[model samples]
Target: MNKLSCILLTLLAWLQYSLWLGKNGIYDFINIYNTTKLYENINDITQMRFRNNQLLYEIYDLLHGYEAVEERSRYNLGMIKIDETFYQIKL
Candidate 1:
């Protein structure tokens, strides 16, 4: 009876070890989950930085008055100075 009980206890310990530390175990799952979360956070921060840079560039352009306005008007509204002739060439 003692030998049988010892074997059962050893088997139980091995099962516990496999459950917590084996391939695709709880520990591995937790580690991979944490790594995924860290990468997602880094991606969010990078996107935010990109947006901030774009906004800063826009603010700089806005602060530069006429050049920015004229560029935007020419491209977006197709406006021209009164004395300048407009030309459109088709390819």
Candidate 2:
């Protein structure tokens, strides 16, 4: 009886160890989850920076890019220079 009890206790301890610290354990899962979250945040930051750069470029263009401003005025505001003729053809 004593030997059987000792064997059972050892088996139980091994099972507990495997559950807590074996392959594919909770610690590994948590680490993977944290890494995924960190990467997601980094991706978000990269996207925001790209958008920010685009906005800054547009702002600079509006402030100093005469060609862009002229095109915008011609297309969006239907503006024409004093010496230019405006004609519209419909097909």
Candidate 3:
């Protein structure tokens, strides 16, 4: 009886050791984590919100005046007046 009990105790100890400190152990738990991805998503959301705010401001400016339209056309559409000369410089 004593020998059988000792063998069972040794087996139980080994299983507990593996469960606590071995591969797929509770201490590390590396494979199942997604906190980094969640943080990345949070950062992306903040950036998207900032971009949306900038777009909304631009929309408000465009709605209120023609100067915003002119500037947007000059820069985005590469437009110029009939008497104006367009210059390009590359560095």
Candidate 4:
């Protein structure tokens, strides 16, 4: 039964190949998982850069823009200019 044995061996080899290299196999799963993780990391870096740019702009505004300084002083430090009268309304 040498031919029968050869057929069974070929079938086993094909099954092994299908198991490892077929669609939705372990290699594909790992590759997709790694790609997803890489994209997630890239997105995280992009978001961090966006936040950094926003902070840099805010710093620039606070340093050079009088309106920003005035707003921050009024809201955060409870400050008013000498010529401006402070009025408080109770809610």
- Cα TM-score per model: 0.52, 0.51, 0.42, 0.54
Model 4, 41-82: lDDT tens digits are 878988888999999999999888999989988899999888
Clashing pairs in model 1, backbone N/Cα/C closer than 3 A: none
Global fold similarity of model 1 (TM-score):
0.52
Model 2, position 43, has a per-residue lDDT of: 85
4-80 in candidate 3: lDDT tens per residue? 99999999999999988888887656544566677777789889889999999999999998999999899999989
How many clashing residue pairs appear in each of the predictions shown?
0, 0, 0, 0
Which ranges of candidate 1 are over 4 A from the true structure? 45-91
What are the lDDT figures for the candidates, one per model?
Answer: 0.92, 0.90, 0.88, 0.92
Runs with alpha carbons beyond 4 Å of true place in candidate 4: 1-49
The model with the greater lDDT, 1 or 3, is: 1
Candidate 2 regions off by >4 Å? 1-47
Greater TM-score among 3 and 4 belongs to 4
| Candidate rank order under lDDT | 1, 4, 2, 3
For model 1 the local lDDT of residue 87 reads 90
Query: Which should have the higher lDDT, number 2 or number 4?
Result: 4
